[model samples]
Structure formats: C-alpha cells, structure tokens
Target: MDTYKNVVRILDEVLSLEGRSASFSRDTALLGAIAELDSMAVVSLITALEEQLGISIGDDEIDGDTFATVGALVDFVDAKLKD
Candidate 1:
C-alpha cells in the first residue's frame, strides 16, 4: 500500500478532499475529524485500498479503531502486507 503516501492518496481521492490530506502526518486524526469520512466513504476507502494494494480485508478484521488516525490505517495496511 506504500504505507503513508498511498493511504493519504486513497483518503484524499475517496473523501474528495482535494489535497488536504497531503499535509497529514502519521498523527493526523481521521474518522470524526474529517467530515467527508462517513460510513460510505469508509467502505469505499477500504475497497480502494484492497484493490490498489492487492490486499484482502476480512469482514471480521475491521473496527472503528482502525480508522482512528493516519498512522493507524497505515499500520493496518502494513500488517496486511506483512501477512
């Protein structure tokens, strides 16, 4: 998933946030902080990450904490890549 960069790209594209995510560091908050990151956007983001990164995300493996911050999401993808 290319970790931070790709995750930010996916976030920017999926949320239609222009380039706002470009400045996001690992500590940048997601979920409630971004108005565009609703339930539907989260689903689309997950799909995009799966397709673009060629990683499989099982239904049972997701939770709100996974979307807590940029670092959290990147860590999730990193773990998936390692598997």
Candidate 2:
C-alpha cells in the first residue's frame, strides 16, 4: 500500500486542508507546522487513520514524533499494518 499517499489524503480530510496536502512531501512538517493540526485535529486524524486504513492504533503507540512529519505518520501506519 502507498502509506504516504493515504496518510496525506486522510490528513487533508481530517484537517480540512482542501487539496493543499497534495503538495506535501515526506519531509513536510506536521505537528507544529500546520495551524490546522491542533490537538482535536490530531484526535480526528487518528480516528480517521484507523477507520480509513483498517488499523487499530493503541494510544501508547503515538507520540510527538509520530506527528512530527508526514513521513513519520506514514511510517507509523505502515508499521501498524505490518504488525
């Protein structure tokens, strides 16, 4: 699966970024960079990731690093899918 693309899509939908996320690359910062990605949006993003990606994410599996960049989020989901 293209985890990176899926992560960007879910992020755009969850954060209501319209199509802006289409330009996001793996190095694109997320956690403290995007103003739309507040705490509530993070929760929504997590829920959306779980629902859309068909993966259950334990709360303990997430942290600041997971949201640090688009690459990190995709890696997390990829890792979860592998597990």
Candidate 3:
C-alpha cells in the first residue's frame, strides 16, 4: 500500500475508527475530535508508525499538528522517511 493508504489503515486500527478513515482527506480534522485518540493512542500510533515504516520519531517531534489530520501525519511520516 502507498503511504496514504498505510496511514489510513493505521488510523483505522489505532483509533478504532470502524474503517471511517478511508473517507478522510487532507483537510479532515483529527486530534481533539477523535474520541479514541487519547494520550495512550497517540503513543501507540507513534510506535506503530515507526515500526511499520522503519523510521524513528523523536519525543520532541510530536505536536498537535502531527496528529491534526491524516494528511498531516502522513506528511510527517513521509518527511521522516525521506531523511
């Protein structure tokens, strides 16, 4: 799967979004809206993303924007992979 698709799947599984992530777009707001995206879920998503993509996410790299939307998160992952 491509980066966006992988990101959608990860969001679905991590957030228990019931596959709602498929319709998510770059402008779709996440973060505070998603009920399952608490602190624990955030950490879980970071770990899962790192393991799946073989990248490292530093603690200081996290922020509201990273979890702001599916697109933002995917872009962040893409940027990390490009490094």
Listed in order, each prediction's TM-score against the native is 0.96, 0.97, 0.92
* Deviation of model 2 at 13, angstroms: 0.5
| Model 1 regions lying over 4 Å from their true place | none
lDDT of 2 by residue, 1-83 (tens): 88888999999999999999999999999999999999999999999999998999998889999999999888889999998
Candidate that would win on TM-score: 2
Better of 1 and 2 by lDDT: 2
Residue pairs clashing, model 1: none
lDDT of 3 by residue, 12-78 (tens): 9888889898788977888998888999999999989989889999999989989898789889998
At residue 18, candidate 1 shows an lDDT of: 94
Q: Write the per-residue lDDT of candidate 1 for residues 1-83, one digit (tens) a residue.
A: 26889899999999999999989999999999999999999999999999998899998999999999999999999999889
Best by lDDT: 2
Best of the two (2, 3) by lDDT: 2
Model 3: clashing residue pairs? none
Instruction: Sort every candidate by TM-score, greatest first.
Output: 2, 1, 3
